[model samples]
Target: MSKIKLRPKSPVRLVATLTFLLISLQIASIIGQYLAHQFSIHRAIDVVERRISLDSAFLDVGNETLNTPANRYAIERYLERLEKVLEEKNLPVVVSEIQGVRTKSDLTEFPRLHRTTFENAEQTISISINSRNPLNEVGISWLSIILALLISPLFAFTSKKRRAQSAREEIVLPPKPRLVINLQEKTISNGIDDKVVTLQNKPLCFYTALVKYCIDNPNESLPPHKDVPHELMALANKCFGRLIELGHTKRKRPDFNANLDKTLSEIRAALDDVFTGYIDEKETYYPPRAQGEGSRSKQHSYALPSIKEDDIEIIGN
Candidate 1:
Protein backbone atom coordinates (compact mmCIF):
# COMPACT_ATOMS: atom_id res chain seq x y z
CA MET A 1 0.00 0.00 0.00
CA SER A 2 1.27 3.46 -0.85
CA LYS A 3 2.19 5.60 2.14
CA ILE A 4 0.22 8.84 2.58
CA LYS A 5 2.22 11.23 4.67
CA LEU A 6 1.10 14.51 6.15
CA ARG A 7 3.98 16.47 7.60
CA PRO A 8 3.53 18.12 10.97
CA LYS A 9 3.27 21.86 10.45
CA SER A 10 5.67 24.08 12.42
CA PRO A 11 4.71 27.60 13.40
CA VAL A 12 6.90 28.98 10.61
CA ARG A 13 5.47 26.49 8.19
CA LEU A 14 1.99 27.29 9.30
CA VAL A 15 2.51 30.98 8.67
CA ALA A 16 4.23 30.27 5.38
CA THR A 17 1.45 27.99 4.31
CA LEU A 18 -1.13 30.67 5.00
CA THR A 19 0.99 33.19 3.15
CA PHE A 20 1.32 30.88 0.19
CA LEU A 21 -2.40 30.28 0.18
CA LEU A 22 -3.02 34.01 0.23
CA ILE A 23 -0.59 34.67 -2.60
CA SER A 24 -1.83 31.79 -4.71
CA LEU A 25 -5.31 33.14 -4.40
CA GLN A 26 -4.05 36.65 -5.20
CA ILE A 27 -4.90 37.89 -1.74
CA ALA A 28 -1.66 39.82 -1.74
CA SER A 29 -3.35 42.59 -3.66
CA ILE A 30 -6.03 42.72 -1.06
CA ILE A 31 -3.41 42.91 1.64
CA GLY A 32 -1.23 45.34 -0.27
CA GLN A 33 -4.03 47.82 0.23
CA TYR A 34 -2.97 48.36 3.84
CA LEU A 35 0.55 49.20 2.77
CA ALA A 36 -0.72 51.78 0.32
CA HIS A 37 -3.03 53.25 2.90
CA GLN A 38 -0.27 53.52 5.48
CA PHE A 39 1.94 55.14 2.90
CA SER A 40 -0.71 57.76 2.20
CA ILE A 41 -1.03 58.55 5.88
CA HIS A 42 2.69 58.77 6.28
CA ARG A 43 3.00 60.96 3.26
CA ALA A 44 0.21 63.17 4.46
CA ILE A 45 1.63 63.49 7.93
CA ASP A 46 5.05 64.28 6.53
CA VAL A 47 3.57 66.83 4.19
CA VAL A 48 1.33 68.46 6.75
CA GLU A 49 3.80 68.58 9.60
CA ARG A 50 6.52 70.01 7.42
CA ARG A 51 4.08 72.49 5.92
CA ILE A 52 3.00 73.76 9.31
CA SER A 53 6.51 74.12 10.69
CA LEU A 54 7.84 75.67 7.55
CA ASP A 55 4.86 77.97 7.31
CA SER A 56 5.67 79.19 10.78
CA ALA A 57 9.36 79.62 10.02
CA PHE A 58 8.58 81.47 6.83
CA LEU A 59 6.92 84.07 9.01
CA ASP A 60 9.99 84.38 11.22
CA VAL A 61 13.04 83.86 8.92
CA GLY A 62 13.00 87.36 7.48
CA ASN A 63 13.07 88.73 11.04
CA GLU A 64 13.59 92.48 11.23
CA THR A 65 14.93 92.25 14.77
CA LEU A 66 16.45 95.80 14.45
CA ASN A 67 18.80 96.11 17.46
CA THR A 68 17.35 92.79 18.63
CA PRO A 69 19.37 90.99 15.94
CA ALA A 70 20.33 88.42 18.60
CA ASN A 71 16.75 87.16 18.83
CA ARG A 72 16.49 87.13 15.05
CA TYR A 73 19.87 85.44 14.75
CA ALA A 74 18.91 82.89 17.38
CA ILE A 75 15.90 81.79 15.34
CA GLU A 76 17.96 81.67 12.11
CA ARG A 77 20.65 79.72 13.95
CA TYR A 78 18.11 77.11 14.97
CA LEU A 79 16.94 76.80 11.38
CA GLU A 80 20.52 76.42 10.11
CA ARG A 81 21.16 73.54 12.48
CA LEU A 82 18.03 71.85 11.19
CA GLU A 83 19.22 72.23 7.60
CA LYS A 84 22.50 70.54 8.43
CA VAL A 85 20.66 67.57 9.94
CA LEU A 86 18.46 67.25 6.85
CA GLU A 87 21.48 67.40 4.60
CA GLU A 88 23.13 64.61 6.59
CA LYS A 89 20.01 62.50 6.16
CA ASN A 90 19.91 63.32 2.43
CA LEU A 91 16.29 64.39 2.71
CA PRO A 92 14.61 66.65 0.16
CA VAL A 93 14.76 70.37 0.84
CA VAL A 94 13.47 73.30 -1.18
CA VAL A 95 12.98 77.05 -0.75
CA SER A 96 10.87 79.26 -2.95
CA GLU A 97 8.89 82.50 -2.78
CA ILE A 98 5.62 82.22 -0.95
CA GLN A 99 2.64 82.25 -3.27
CA GLY A 100 -0.53 84.27 -2.82
CA VAL A 101 -0.37 87.70 -1.21
CA ARG A 102 -0.59 87.04 2.51
CA THR A 103 -0.11 89.79 5.09
CA LYS A 104 2.28 89.37 7.97
CA SER A 105 4.42 91.45 10.36
CA ASP A 106 7.61 92.70 8.63
CA LEU A 107 9.17 93.00 12.11
CA THR A 108 11.25 89.84 11.45
CA GLU A 109 9.00 86.76 10.90
CA PHE A 110 7.10 87.10 7.61
CA PRO A 111 8.73 84.18 5.76
CA ARG A 112 5.87 83.88 3.24
CA LEU A 113 7.18 80.54 2.05
CA HIS A 114 6.52 78.33 -0.98
CA ARG A 115 8.36 75.44 -2.53
CA THR A 116 7.70 72.18 -4.39
CA THR A 117 8.02 69.33 -1.90
CA PHE A 118 10.50 66.59 -2.71
CA GLU A 119 11.88 63.40 -1.22
CA ASN A 120 13.20 59.99 -2.19
CA ALA A 121 10.44 57.71 -3.42
CA GLU A 122 11.68 55.05 -1.07
CA GLN A 123 11.90 57.46 1.86
CA THR A 124 9.34 60.07 0.70
CA ILE A 125 10.71 62.89 2.90
CA SER A 126 9.91 66.40 1.90
CA ILE A 127 11.41 69.84 2.48
CA SER A 128 10.56 70.55 6.08
CA ILE A 129 11.24 74.24 5.99
CA ASN A 130 12.58 76.82 3.60
CA SER A 131 14.84 78.24 6.33
CA ARG A 132 16.94 76.27 8.80
CA ASN A 133 16.24 78.78 11.58
CA PRO A 134 14.71 77.93 14.97
CA LEU A 135 14.78 74.28 13.83
CA ASN A 136 11.13 73.99 14.92
CA GLU A 137 10.09 72.04 11.82
CA VAL A 138 13.38 70.77 10.54
CA GLY A 139 13.62 67.11 9.41
CA ILE A 140 10.24 66.33 10.94
CA SER A 141 8.83 65.78 7.46
CA TRP A 142 11.55 63.30 6.56
CA LEU A 143 11.29 61.36 9.78
CA SER A 144 7.51 61.31 9.84
CA ILE A 145 7.01 59.95 6.33
CA ILE A 146 9.84 57.48 6.62
CA LEU A 147 8.46 56.15 9.85
CA ALA A 148 4.98 56.05 8.34
CA LEU A 149 6.20 54.19 5.27
CA LEU A 150 8.17 51.71 7.35
CA ILE A 151 5.35 51.05 9.80
CA SER A 152 2.72 50.81 7.10
CA PRO A 153 4.06 47.49 5.81
CA LEU A 154 4.20 46.08 9.30
CA PHE A 155 0.61 47.08 9.93
CA ALA A 156 -0.43 45.56 6.62
CA PHE A 157 1.44 42.35 7.39
CA THR A 158 -0.14 42.18 10.82
CA SER A 159 -3.58 42.71 9.34
CA LYS A 160 -3.16 39.82 6.90
CA LYS A 161 -1.80 37.60 9.66
CA ARG A 162 -4.78 38.37 11.85
CA ARG A 163 -7.17 37.74 9.01
CA ALA A 164 -5.48 34.45 8.23
CA GLN A 165 -5.67 33.40 11.85
CA SER A 166 -9.29 34.45 12.05
CA ALA A 167 -10.13 32.44 8.93
CA ARG A 168 -8.34 29.40 10.32
CA GLU A 169 -10.14 29.74 13.61
CA GLU A 170 -13.48 30.02 11.88
CA ILE A 171 -12.65 26.92 9.91
CA VAL A 172 -11.81 25.01 13.07
CA LEU A 173 -14.99 26.13 14.78
CA PRO A 174 -17.67 23.46 14.93
CA PRO A 175 -20.58 24.66 12.87
CA LYS A 176 -22.12 27.74 14.46
CA PRO A 177 -25.68 28.39 15.54
CA ARG A 178 -27.66 27.47 12.45
CA LEU A 179 -30.66 29.71 12.06
CA VAL A 180 -34.04 28.04 12.25
CA ILE A 181 -35.99 31.19 11.57
CA ASN A 182 -37.28 32.33 8.20
CA LEU A 183 -35.05 35.38 8.13
CA GLN A 184 -35.31 38.20 5.69
CA GLU A 185 -31.67 38.29 4.59
CA LYS A 186 -29.90 41.47 3.65
CA THR A 187 -26.65 42.11 1.81
CA ILE A 188 -24.51 43.97 4.31
CA SER A 189 -22.65 46.98 3.00
CA ASN A 190 -19.14 47.94 4.16
CA GLY A 191 -20.52 50.16 6.91
CA ILE A 192 -19.63 49.44 10.53
CA ASP A 193 -23.16 48.41 11.48
CA ASP A 194 -24.29 46.68 8.31
CA LYS A 195 -26.42 43.63 9.13
CA VAL A 196 -26.92 40.42 7.21
CA VAL A 197 -28.31 36.96 7.95
CA THR A 198 -28.16 33.63 6.15
CA LEU A 199 -29.82 30.37 7.04
CA GLN A 200 -29.77 26.98 5.39
CA ASN A 201 -32.86 28.14 3.64
CA LYS A 202 -33.57 31.80 4.34
CA PRO A 203 -33.86 33.75 7.57
CA LEU A 204 -36.33 36.36 8.85
CA CYS A 205 -35.81 39.90 10.12
CA PHE A 206 -33.39 42.47 8.77
CA TYR A 207 -32.66 45.90 10.22
CA THR A 208 -30.15 48.75 9.87
CA ALA A 209 -28.95 51.22 12.48
CA LEU A 210 -26.03 53.53 13.12
CA VAL A 211 -23.01 51.68 14.49
CA LYS A 212 -21.60 54.10 17.03
CA TYR A 213 -22.75 55.81 20.21
CA CYS A 214 -19.93 58.27 19.69
CA ILE A 215 -21.92 60.12 17.06
CA ASP A 216 -25.44 61.35 16.61
CA ASN A 217 -27.74 58.79 14.93
CA PRO A 218 -26.95 60.29 11.55
CA ASN A 219 -23.30 60.86 12.43
CA GLU A 220 -22.86 57.15 12.93
CA SER A 221 -22.08 54.60 10.20
CA LEU A 222 -18.49 55.63 9.63
CA PRO A 223 -16.64 53.36 7.20
CA PRO A 224 -15.98 51.07 10.14
CA HIS A 225 -19.45 50.72 11.64
CA LYS A 226 -20.10 49.23 15.08
CA ASP A 227 -21.28 45.95 13.56
CA VAL A 228 -17.65 45.14 12.70
CA PRO A 229 -14.75 45.04 15.12
CA HIS A 230 -13.51 48.59 15.55
CA GLU A 231 -9.80 47.88 15.11
CA LEU A 232 -10.43 45.54 12.22
CA MET A 233 -12.75 48.01 10.54
CA ALA A 234 -10.35 50.87 11.19
CA LEU A 235 -7.50 48.99 9.62
CA ALA A 236 -9.72 47.88 6.78
CA ASN A 237 -11.04 51.38 6.18
CA LYS A 238 -7.52 52.73 6.21
CA CYS A 239 -6.85 50.36 3.36
CA PHE A 240 -10.33 50.66 1.88
CA GLY A 241 -9.45 53.56 -0.35
CA ARG A 242 -6.31 51.77 -1.47
CA LEU A 243 -8.35 48.75 -2.44
CA ILE A 244 -10.43 51.09 -4.48
CA GLU A 245 -7.17 52.21 -6.08
CA LEU A 246 -6.56 48.57 -7.03
CA GLY A 247 -9.18 48.84 -9.74
CA HIS A 248 -11.87 47.73 -7.35
CA THR A 249 -15.38 48.76 -8.24
CA LYS A 250 -18.34 49.37 -6.03
CA ARG A 251 -21.52 47.48 -6.69
CA LYS A 252 -24.44 46.46 -4.51
CA ARG A 253 -21.86 44.08 -3.09
CA PRO A 254 -18.22 45.05 -3.29
CA ASP A 255 -15.89 42.52 -4.89
CA PHE A 256 -12.85 43.79 -3.01
CA ASN A 257 -11.43 42.39 0.22
CA ALA A 258 -11.72 45.18 2.83
CA ASN A 259 -15.25 45.75 1.68
CA LEU A 260 -16.01 42.05 1.67
CA ASP A 261 -14.51 41.56 5.11
CA LYS A 262 -16.41 44.53 6.41
CA THR A 263 -19.57 43.25 4.80
CA LEU A 264 -19.16 39.73 6.17
CA SER A 265 -18.37 40.97 9.68
CA GLU A 266 -21.35 43.30 9.76
CA ILE A 267 -23.61 40.59 8.43
CA ARG A 268 -22.45 38.20 11.10
CA ALA A 269 -22.97 40.85 13.74
CA ALA A 270 -26.43 41.52 12.38
CA LEU A 271 -27.19 37.81 12.46
CA ASP A 272 -25.95 37.64 16.01
CA ASP A 273 -28.05 40.62 16.94
CA VAL A 274 -31.22 39.13 15.52
CA PHE A 275 -30.48 35.75 17.01
CA THR A 276 -29.87 37.28 20.41
CA GLY A 277 -33.01 39.34 20.08
CA TYR A 278 -35.05 36.30 19.19
CA ILE A 279 -33.51 34.27 21.97
CA ASP A 280 -34.22 37.05 24.43
CA GLU A 281 -37.86 37.22 23.37
CA LYS A 282 -38.33 33.46 23.19
CA GLU A 283 -36.42 32.62 26.34
CA THR A 284 -38.18 35.38 28.27
CA TYR A 285 -41.44 33.55 27.73
CA TYR A 286 -41.18 31.48 30.95
CA PRO A 287 -41.05 27.66 30.69
CA PRO A 288 -40.38 28.31 27.06
CA ARG A 289 -42.00 26.13 24.40
CA ALA A 290 -44.53 23.68 25.97
CA GLN A 291 -43.42 23.48 29.59
CA GLY A 292 -39.93 23.00 28.18
CA GLU A 293 -36.84 25.15 28.98
CA GLY A 294 -36.01 27.91 26.56
CA SER A 295 -34.17 26.88 23.36
CA ARG A 296 -31.22 29.03 24.49
CA SER A 297 -29.28 29.64 27.67
CA LYS A 298 -31.15 31.35 30.50
CA GLN A 299 -28.08 33.45 31.16
CA HIS A 300 -25.99 34.63 28.19
CA SER A 301 -27.62 33.75 24.89
CA TYR A 302 -25.73 33.10 21.62
CA ALA A 303 -28.89 33.54 19.60
CA LEU A 304 -29.30 30.40 17.52
CA PRO A 305 -32.77 30.45 16.04
CA SER A 306 -35.26 28.03 17.51
CA ILE A 307 -37.84 25.83 15.74
CA LYS A 308 -40.65 27.61 17.61
CA GLU A 309 -42.51 26.56 20.79
CA ASP A 310 -44.73 24.04 18.95
CA ASP A 311 -41.77 22.46 17.17
CA ILE A 312 -38.75 20.57 18.60
CA GLU A 313 -39.15 19.82 22.32
CA ILE A 314 -36.28 20.20 24.81
CA ILE A 315 -34.65 16.93 25.79
CA GLY A 316 -35.49 17.77 29.45
CA ASN A 317 -37.67 20.55 30.78
Candidate 2:
Protein backbone atom coordinates (compact mmCIF):
# COMPACT_ATOMS: atom_id res chain seq x y z
CA MET A 1 0.00 0.00 0.00
CA SER A 2 1.23 3.47 -0.93
CA LYS A 3 0.92 6.39 1.56
CA ILE A 4 -0.62 9.64 0.34
CA LYS A 5 1.12 12.86 1.43
CA LEU A 6 -0.87 16.01 2.20
CA ARG A 7 0.54 19.43 1.29
CA PRO A 8 0.47 22.38 3.69
CA LYS A 9 -2.29 24.99 3.14
CA SER A 10 -1.13 28.35 1.75
CA PRO A 11 -2.30 31.77 3.06
CA VAL A 12 -5.23 31.99 0.65
CA ARG A 13 -6.40 28.54 1.65
CA LEU A 14 -6.15 29.50 5.32
CA VAL A 15 -8.33 32.56 4.67
CA ALA A 16 -10.83 30.34 2.85
CA THR A 17 -10.92 28.00 5.80
CA LEU A 18 -11.65 30.86 8.17
CA THR A 19 -14.45 32.03 5.88
CA PHE A 20 -15.94 28.54 5.86
CA LEU A 21 -15.86 28.48 9.67
CA LEU A 22 -17.68 31.79 9.81
CA ILE A 23 -20.35 30.47 7.49
CA SER A 24 -20.79 27.38 9.64
CA LEU A 25 -21.12 29.51 12.77
CA GLN A 26 -23.75 31.68 11.08
CA ILE A 27 -25.70 28.53 10.11
CA ALA A 28 -25.61 27.35 13.70
CA SER A 29 -26.88 30.73 14.88
CA ILE A 30 -29.79 30.51 12.42
CA ILE A 31 -30.69 27.03 13.64
CA GLY A 32 -30.62 28.27 17.24
CA GLN A 33 -32.97 31.15 16.32
CA TYR A 34 -35.62 28.83 14.84
CA LEU A 35 -35.44 26.53 17.84
CA ALA A 36 -36.00 29.51 20.14
CA HIS A 37 -39.01 30.56 18.05
CA GLN A 38 -40.56 27.08 18.32
CA PHE A 39 -40.06 27.11 22.10
CA SER A 40 -41.80 30.49 22.40
CA ILE A 41 -44.81 29.28 20.35
CA HIS A 42 -45.16 26.11 22.44
CA ARG A 43 -45.00 28.10 25.69
CA ALA A 44 -47.69 30.56 24.50
CA ILE A 45 -50.00 27.68 23.56
CA ASP A 46 -49.47 26.04 26.95
CA VAL A 47 -50.40 29.26 28.75
CA VAL A 48 -53.66 29.58 26.72
CA GLU A 49 -54.53 25.93 27.39
CA ARG A 50 -54.01 26.25 31.14
CA ARG A 51 -56.19 29.36 31.32
CA ILE A 52 -59.01 27.54 29.44
CA SER A 53 -58.81 24.48 31.74
CA LEU A 54 -59.08 26.69 34.85
CA ASP A 55 -62.18 28.44 33.38
CA SER A 56 -63.83 25.03 32.70
CA ALA A 57 -63.18 23.87 36.27
CA PHE A 58 -64.76 26.99 37.72
CA LEU A 59 -67.82 26.43 35.52
CA ASP A 60 -68.34 22.90 36.85
CA VAL A 61 -68.37 24.10 40.48
CA GLY A 62 -71.14 26.39 41.74
CA ASN A 63 -70.41 30.12 42.23
CA GLU A 64 -72.02 30.04 45.75
CA THR A 65 -69.61 27.30 46.78
CA LEU A 66 -67.61 29.04 49.54
CA ASN A 67 -63.93 28.42 50.39
CA THR A 68 -64.43 24.67 50.94
CA PRO A 69 -61.41 22.30 51.07
CA ALA A 70 -62.02 20.99 47.53
CA ASN A 71 -62.70 24.48 46.08
CA ARG A 72 -59.60 26.01 47.78
CA TYR A 73 -57.51 23.08 46.63
CA ALA A 74 -58.59 23.62 43.01
CA ILE A 75 -57.91 27.40 43.29
CA GLU A 76 -54.42 26.75 44.72
CA ARG A 77 -53.65 24.36 41.85
CA TYR A 78 -54.80 26.97 39.32
CA LEU A 79 -52.62 29.67 40.92
CA GLU A 80 -49.58 27.32 40.78
CA ARG A 81 -50.08 26.59 37.06
CA LEU A 82 -50.47 30.35 36.36
CA GLU A 83 -47.23 31.06 38.24
CA LYS A 84 -45.39 28.44 36.23
CA VAL A 85 -46.70 29.95 32.97
CA LEU A 86 -45.63 33.43 34.12
CA GLU A 87 -42.11 32.17 34.82
CA GLU A 88 -41.84 30.45 31.43
CA LYS A 89 -43.20 33.43 29.46
CA ASN A 90 -41.04 35.93 31.48
CA LEU A 91 -44.07 38.24 32.09
CA PRO A 92 -47.33 38.65 34.00
CA VAL A 93 -50.78 37.07 33.23
CA VAL A 94 -54.14 38.32 34.61
CA VAL A 95 -57.24 36.09 35.08
CA SER A 96 -60.48 37.21 36.75
CA GLU A 97 -62.34 34.86 39.20
CA ILE A 98 -65.69 36.13 40.35
CA GLN A 99 -67.75 34.30 43.00
CA GLY A 100 -70.99 36.05 43.96
CA VAL A 101 -74.78 35.70 44.28
CA ARG A 102 -76.63 35.01 41.04
CA THR A 103 -77.65 38.60 40.33
CA LYS A 104 -78.56 40.26 37.00
CA SER A 105 -75.85 42.92 37.61
CA ASP A 106 -73.16 40.23 38.13
CA LEU A 107 -74.33 38.25 35.13
CA THR A 108 -73.75 41.31 32.87
CA GLU A 109 -69.98 41.10 33.67
CA PHE A 110 -69.45 37.70 31.99
CA PRO A 111 -71.42 36.70 28.87
CA ARG A 112 -70.49 32.98 29.13
CA LEU A 113 -71.34 32.69 32.84
CA HIS A 114 -70.69 29.34 34.54
CA ARG A 115 -70.82 29.30 38.38
CA THR A 116 -72.19 32.73 39.27
CA THR A 117 -74.52 33.11 42.38
CA PHE A 118 -75.08 35.30 45.45
CA GLU A 119 -71.37 35.34 46.57
CA ASN A 120 -68.84 37.31 48.71
CA ALA A 121 -66.05 38.80 46.41
CA GLU A 122 -64.04 38.60 43.25
CA GLN A 123 -60.64 36.91 42.60
CA THR A 124 -58.67 38.28 39.74
CA ILE A 125 -55.76 36.82 37.63
CA SER A 126 -54.02 39.01 35.04
CA ILE A 127 -52.90 37.41 31.77
CA SER A 128 -50.13 39.53 30.14
CA ILE A 129 -48.97 38.61 26.63
CA ASN A 130 -45.18 37.94 26.58
CA SER A 131 -44.75 38.61 22.87
CA ARG A 132 -46.96 39.07 19.74
CA ASN A 133 -44.72 37.22 17.23
CA PRO A 134 -46.27 33.99 15.87
CA LEU A 135 -44.60 30.59 15.81
CA ASN A 136 -41.76 30.07 13.21
CA GLU A 137 -42.87 26.77 11.71
CA VAL A 138 -39.98 26.83 9.16
CA GLY A 139 -36.25 27.36 9.79
CA ILE A 140 -34.18 29.95 7.80
CA SER A 141 -30.80 28.27 8.37
CA TRP A 142 -30.52 27.68 4.61
CA LEU A 143 -30.64 31.48 3.99
CA SER A 144 -27.54 32.04 6.14
CA ILE A 145 -25.76 29.25 4.30
CA ILE A 146 -26.69 30.78 0.95
CA LEU A 147 -25.49 34.27 1.99
CA ALA A 148 -22.19 32.90 3.23
CA LEU A 149 -21.70 30.94 0.03
CA LEU A 150 -22.35 34.12 -1.98
CA ILE A 151 -20.21 36.51 0.09
CA SER A 152 -17.23 34.27 0.93
CA PRO A 153 -16.23 33.78 -2.69
CA LEU A 154 -16.41 37.57 -3.25
CA PHE A 155 -14.25 38.26 -0.20
CA ALA A 156 -11.68 35.68 -1.31
CA PHE A 157 -11.57 37.13 -4.81
CA THR A 158 -10.97 40.67 -3.49
CA SER A 159 -8.19 39.43 -1.18
CA LYS A 160 -6.57 37.58 -4.07
CA LYS A 161 -6.64 40.72 -6.24
CA ARG A 162 -5.01 42.81 -3.49
CA ARG A 163 -2.29 40.21 -2.92
CA ALA A 164 -1.56 39.96 -6.65
CA GLN A 165 -1.32 43.76 -6.94
CA SER A 166 1.16 43.95 -4.06
CA ALA A 167 3.27 41.19 -5.62
CA ARG A 168 3.39 43.01 -8.94
CA GLU A 169 4.49 46.25 -7.28
CA GLU A 170 7.34 44.45 -5.52
CA ILE A 171 8.54 42.98 -8.80
CA VAL A 172 8.09 46.06 -11.05
CA LEU A 173 9.56 48.89 -8.97
CA PRO A 174 13.33 49.51 -8.96
CA PRO A 175 15.37 50.04 -5.82
CA LYS A 176 16.60 53.56 -5.06
CA PRO A 177 20.20 54.57 -5.84
CA ARG A 178 22.50 55.15 -2.87
CA LEU A 179 24.24 58.54 -2.90
CA VAL A 180 27.67 58.81 -1.15
CA ILE A 181 29.18 62.26 -1.63
CA ASN A 182 32.69 62.58 -0.16
CA LEU A 183 33.33 66.35 -0.18
CA GLN A 184 36.90 65.86 1.21
CA GLU A 185 38.42 65.59 -2.28
CA LYS A 186 37.58 66.37 -5.96
CA THR A 187 39.43 65.80 -9.28
CA ILE A 188 38.83 67.43 -12.67
CA SER A 189 40.19 65.91 -15.88
CA ASN A 190 40.62 67.70 -19.19
CA GLY A 191 39.98 64.86 -21.67
CA ILE A 192 41.67 66.82 -24.47
CA ASP A 193 44.96 67.46 -22.59
CA ASP A 194 44.78 64.45 -20.25
CA LYS A 195 45.37 66.82 -17.33
CA VAL A 196 43.82 66.04 -13.91
CA VAL A 197 43.17 68.18 -10.82
CA THR A 198 41.81 67.13 -7.34
CA LEU A 199 40.05 69.06 -4.59
CA GLN A 200 39.86 67.31 -1.19
CA ASN A 201 39.81 63.93 -3.10
CA LYS A 202 36.48 64.71 -4.88
CA PRO A 203 36.51 64.26 -8.66
CA LEU A 204 36.09 67.47 -10.68
CA CYS A 205 35.80 66.32 -14.27
CA PHE A 206 35.85 68.59 -17.39
CA TYR A 207 32.27 69.78 -16.84
CA THR A 208 32.95 70.67 -13.16
CA ALA A 209 36.15 72.53 -14.02
CA LEU A 210 34.36 74.34 -16.82
CA VAL A 211 31.65 75.40 -14.39
CA LYS A 212 34.28 76.77 -11.98
CA TYR A 213 36.15 78.44 -14.82
CA CYS A 214 32.89 80.03 -15.94
CA ILE A 215 32.28 81.30 -12.40
CA ASP A 216 35.72 83.00 -12.43
CA ASN A 217 35.53 84.21 -16.06
CA PRO A 218 31.85 84.73 -16.71
CA ASN A 219 32.30 86.49 -20.03
CA GLU A 220 34.95 84.06 -21.44
CA SER A 221 35.06 80.37 -22.36
CA LEU A 222 37.78 77.72 -22.10
CA PRO A 223 39.76 77.86 -25.39
CA PRO A 224 40.68 74.18 -25.74
CA HIS A 225 38.01 72.56 -23.45
CA LYS A 226 36.31 69.33 -24.47
CA ASP A 227 32.56 69.01 -24.96
CA VAL A 228 30.61 68.44 -21.69
CA PRO A 229 28.29 65.44 -21.20
CA HIS A 230 24.68 66.21 -20.15
CA GLU A 231 24.86 64.30 -16.85
CA LEU A 232 28.19 65.90 -15.90
CA MET A 233 26.89 69.38 -16.74
CA ALA A 234 23.85 68.86 -14.49
CA LEU A 235 26.02 67.64 -11.57
CA ALA A 236 28.46 70.54 -11.94
CA ASN A 237 25.56 73.01 -12.08
CA LYS A 238 24.06 71.55 -8.87
CA CYS A 239 27.37 71.81 -6.98
CA PHE A 240 28.06 75.40 -8.12
CA GLY A 241 24.44 76.45 -7.54
CA ARG A 242 24.55 75.41 -3.84
CA LEU A 243 27.60 77.58 -3.15
CA ILE A 244 26.12 80.52 -5.06
CA GLU A 245 22.87 80.21 -3.11
CA LEU A 246 24.77 80.07 0.23
CA GLY A 247 26.71 83.18 -0.72
CA HIS A 248 23.47 85.04 -1.56
CA THR A 249 21.70 84.19 1.74
CA LYS A 250 20.99 87.16 4.08
CA ARG A 251 21.93 85.19 7.24
CA LYS A 252 25.06 86.55 8.94
CA ARG A 253 27.81 83.94 9.56
CA PRO A 254 30.91 86.01 8.89
CA ASP A 255 33.50 83.59 10.31
CA PHE A 256 32.03 80.50 8.60
CA ASN A 257 31.77 82.17 5.19
CA ALA A 258 35.19 83.70 5.66
CA ASN A 259 36.77 80.31 6.25
CA LEU A 260 34.93 78.80 3.28
CA ASP A 261 36.09 81.70 1.09
CA LYS A 262 39.69 81.27 2.35
CA THR A 263 39.62 77.54 1.46
CA LEU A 264 38.35 78.37 -2.04
CA SER A 265 41.00 81.08 -2.40
CA GLU A 266 43.69 78.52 -1.46
CA ILE A 267 42.34 76.09 -4.06
CA ARG A 268 42.52 78.81 -6.73
CA ALA A 269 46.00 79.74 -5.48
CA ALA A 270 47.07 76.09 -5.83
CA LEU A 271 45.69 75.99 -9.38
CA ASP A 272 47.55 79.24 -10.13
CA ASP A 273 50.73 77.77 -8.59
CA VAL A 274 50.37 74.70 -10.84
CA PHE A 275 49.84 76.87 -13.94
CA THR A 276 52.82 79.15 -13.04
CA GLY A 277 55.30 76.19 -12.70
CA TYR A 278 55.76 77.04 -8.98
CA ILE A 279 54.08 73.78 -7.74
CA ASP A 280 57.49 71.89 -7.58
CA GLU A 281 59.34 74.51 -5.44
CA LYS A 282 58.29 75.16 -1.86
CA GLU A 283 58.97 78.90 -2.35
CA THR A 284 56.44 81.42 -3.77
CA TYR A 285 57.57 83.25 -6.97
CA TYR A 286 57.11 87.01 -7.14
CA PRO A 287 57.36 88.34 -10.74
CA PRO A 288 59.57 91.41 -11.30
CA ARG A 289 57.69 94.74 -11.23
CA ALA A 290 57.41 97.03 -14.33
CA GLN A 291 58.86 99.92 -12.24
CA GLY A 292 55.39 101.50 -12.06
CA GLU A 293 52.56 101.58 -9.40
CA GLY A 294 48.77 101.75 -9.81
CA SER A 295 45.60 100.60 -7.97
CA ARG A 296 44.74 98.09 -10.78
CA SER A 297 48.33 97.10 -11.64
CA LYS A 298 48.56 94.87 -8.53
CA GLN A 299 46.98 92.10 -10.67
CA HIS A 300 49.54 90.02 -12.61
CA SER A 301 48.88 87.68 -15.50
CA TYR A 302 50.07 84.08 -15.38
CA ALA A 303 49.82 82.60 -18.85
CA LEU A 304 48.58 79.01 -19.26
CA PRO A 305 50.48 76.64 -21.56
CA SER A 306 48.87 76.45 -25.01
CA ILE A 307 48.67 73.31 -27.16
CA LYS A 308 49.15 73.50 -30.95
CA GLU A 309 48.37 70.92 -33.68
CA ASP A 310 52.10 70.06 -33.87
CA ASP A 311 54.07 68.25 -31.14
CA ILE A 312 55.84 71.50 -30.07
CA GLU A 313 53.64 73.45 -27.62
CA ILE A 314 53.80 77.30 -27.25
CA ILE A 315 53.82 79.12 -23.82
CA GLY A 316 52.66 82.75 -23.23
CA ASN A 317 51.07 84.94 -25.93
* Stretches of model 2 off by over 4 angstroms after superposition: 1-75, 80-140, 153-164, 177-198, 201-317
On lDDT, the candidate that comes out on top is 2
**Residue-wise C-alpha lDDT for candidate 1, range 1-317, written one tens digit per residue:** 64433334446755665555444444444345445544543454365456535545443333233322223444445445544554565443322222222222131331324344433222222232332222222222334444444443432323445556689888765332322322122232212222333421111111111121121232222232223334433433433343344434342322222343333344455444544534543332112121234322234222223323332211111
Task: Tell me how many clashing residue pairs each candidate has.
Answer: 21, 28
Task: State which candidate has the highest TM-score.
Answer: 2
Of candidate 2, the 10-residue stretch with the lowest lDDT total is 308-317
Model 2: per-residue Cα lDDT over 20-64, one tens digit each: 856686768766876776576456546654655456445323333
Candidate 1's TM-score: 0.17
Residue 276 deviation, candidate 2, in Å? 33
Model 1 per-residue lDDT at 60? 37
